[model samples]
Target: MHISRRQLIEGSLCGAAAIALKGYAQPSRWQPGTVRHLLPAVSHDRLLLKASFGRPLAAPPTLRAGPRAATGVRLDSSAEFFSFDLAGLEPEHTYELVLEDAAGAPLCDPWPITMFPGPDAAPDRFRLLVYTCAGGHPATVNSDTDSPYFVSIANRRKMLLTGLSYEPDAMIAVGDHVYWDLRSPVGSVMLGNAPEARRLVGAFTRNLPVPGTDNERKLKRVVTPQISDLYGTDFRSTPVYFVQDDHDYFENDEATEEMVTFPPDDFMLRLARATQRLYYPEFLPDANRPAGLPSSGAADRPAGVSESFGTLRFGRLLEIMMYDCRRYMTLTGPVGGFVPETVEEWLMQRMAAEQTRHVVNLPSTPVGWSAGKWGEWYPDLLQPNGELGTARPKYLWQPGWNRQHNRLLQAASAMSGVPLFLSGDLHALGEGRIMRYGDLDFRGNPVVTVLTGPISSGPRAWPSAWRGTPPRTPTGIELEAGLDPLEKNGFSIIDFTEDRVEGQMFNWKMGEPVENLDNLQPFHRFTAARGA
Candidate 1:
């Protein structure tokens, strides 16, 4: 469903049609479906949209500057889809992205596009969100009869509203955006490396004749629409950076790192495609992978499937190293630790930048704390693994990753501002600063680590308090942890400026008797400055 750029912007059937004037609400012939998904993704540079009966008749959507100001791709399935980018937008200006019908009447409510401050714009202030493990299975039901989807949707809406109230410039959804409907048991037992033709007997769906098929279809029903409802208003105006986790990738807590990238027919591959297609904006290659991997419409594009790591910047105040720790990962490292080769270089460069006030390295899996069930990362591996009669491979101190981790820290120490680590998955809110064990150089440059989670999912049980005595990893990088709190169901916030970076964990409840963001206070708060 590729419509050439010329057809969209040029005078097509919709060009001369009656376009609804801006800022005024009017009746529209091109009615949107009950669900209209208008999401702002990528940098402040792109807009992603999905609406039923949502496509414009001929002329492309009219931006603040008009129809001709946009370019990129448009895709249509049962619903109308779009991923158009607006380049050359003025810095700090808010643009209106409006869709219309053949008659030119605006189809859905117009969305606002806010551009980041320009290169010359003051690098003074910006706000970012860090969140993960949003609502999913084992429904936190309002009523016993309510389905998991119903309960999850209610919670998701609350989280979105709370976030919008903060008016963040952008959001970083760290991972577990949507968990597979099946429980974690399925993931542990089956394998992502299985052949595509191997079909599981029960692929669940919201409504199915056989009652247990369309595993991919259930995702569209149970999760995607909830996302549509959650970010309904805010996404139109703000960018949402998606970093996927195991559930969204394959099963519950695993990404298939098979040497061979599976073909389109594979179940796991099919599941990944469905998640990206219905909800998230299309995938783009990181600098590590070449861009413009060919698309076959049904198959996951080459770079799209392979590349998950990328970067984001805001004025000169901040730069983010968004890591894809799950995909392309092995039990141990060769050159790349948990991260891919291309992304490691990109992150290191940012950490070393003199003008970059803050560099936030976000891994979908936490390096600070976790449930200890998963085996790959630092926190998860620290917990005892009964299967091994020991902890998972200690990557933090192991030869494979130790050197890379040290290099990353050294990069931070060499810069003007101490870089911060942002993570989620512990289902708790915690903050801690690192020091080379037993060394009281607390006044020296320190790396800050902040953890927040349980966006709408059930919060995990975290220790009321705990820390290692001069906690030393395999490689002897000594550290300590503190201020950890559990049952704080919400997202993390980071407010950045040249002087300091402040973090807070705000709480949000899932069901009836809705709570107010204003009345609630942060469960934990911490700040990172130039010199510890």
Candidate 2:
């Protein structure tokens, strides 16, 4: 059961040789599963593509336009993964991407990719599929009783594929993409006490080389099953933007008397970075976004890969500014926030600019609701008696986070159009119209906040089941509940246009027939009209 990378390769070669000897056609190294994943993100004239293989490629693969046979440059790569940055592409044009060998033989099947509209070009409509908490393997956590993922990975995949079938223009996956929590107290308890989980997930090594060392192999073993193996090439054609949350760093966001597990340690940061480099495409550069922000344009990162913040611009119609709340979170008392001061300024400026008809603030942490968790913007605390209270200060909750949250909400409410925010990490699907946050009132133009539903969390993982109660409106905020938070495996299809933004939420519960999932339909619907 414990197979080394070299041994796995040797075994694969042996099987391939046997097939060749029996007069069967040999398989291409670029076949699906061998070339583990291909994830691409696009702009009007630029495309960034990332692909990883089961084994290292003997030579760099070429990306070509299937119709015109145009070539794309292969960037410098590491180990088993490579990236491609295709520039000067035509906007709103569809190009068939063909992966080929050195000799020009086709490697994998041709995949068609379309470029987005330019910043100045306004489209009539654009649709997006948004979801969160999509990463987890049932075997890697506690057993059936304690903090278990009640559903199987295959079931989760079906739910995702169902969402994909809706044919949205692009996809936004909010955080908790991977759930291999390691160092935090809860992580330590879940991983240390679960021997079977260790056998299934492998171990995390510290202070080791990133790409070439044995530790890299161990890291691959742990993430492959959760990411590549789970989603495969299902998202290859969709321009997918991934946002990272606390669990993606391999630790739950928690502060304890023993240790503070955020602002990720050097090892945790390296692990998360390496995972992004190997499996997924980072946010491509945007002209309107500053390149000097936290991890954006950092020297250590691959060229054009932005780590902390990104943007999704569909001409002048819609723009989604996505930021990772965990990476740059600071703990300094009243000034500390989930995002840095620079990022906060950038967000406010972007929203105030009113550059697009529909502006969405997408963060990894949800607002307008709380289960009294430590990482939330509100200071509400989950007491021992399973009641939520704000009389006591949270373990390490920063007041600045709430201050920044209110500031953003105020800015959004004052915008010309309806203020909208889509977020995740609470593992539920719901929406709230924030009428007031603290003393700032938005009754005239209530800031609309939404939990975009989770993709992989099972029954045991719901906040109500684990925290002993469901999420509720926090103490300092007054909200009109449009849709109460419901724990299920689901996603949202949001349609953006010049007039209004409409969304349909779809979900399916466990203990039900899996076949029925294929016929799933939107269970809830809501629309936010433009203007007051």
Q: Flag regions of model 1 displaced more than 4 Å.
A: 1-35, 42-76, 137-151, 181-219, 254-266, 282-307, 332-336, 379-403, 437-443, 459-482, 508-518
- What overall lDDT, based on C-alpha atoms, would model 2 receive against the true structure? 0.78
Highest-TM-score candidate: 2
TM-score of each predicted structure versus truth? 0.72, 0.90
lDDT of 2 by residue, 495-526 (tens): 99897999999998777787666567899999
What is the RMSD, in Å, between candidate 2 and the native fold over all Cα? 7.7
Candidate 1: tens digits of C-alpha lDDT, residues 181-206: 24333332322221211242234432
Q: What is each predicted model's overall lDDT from 0 to 1?
A: 0.50, 0.78
- TM-score of candidate 2 relative to the true fold: 0.90
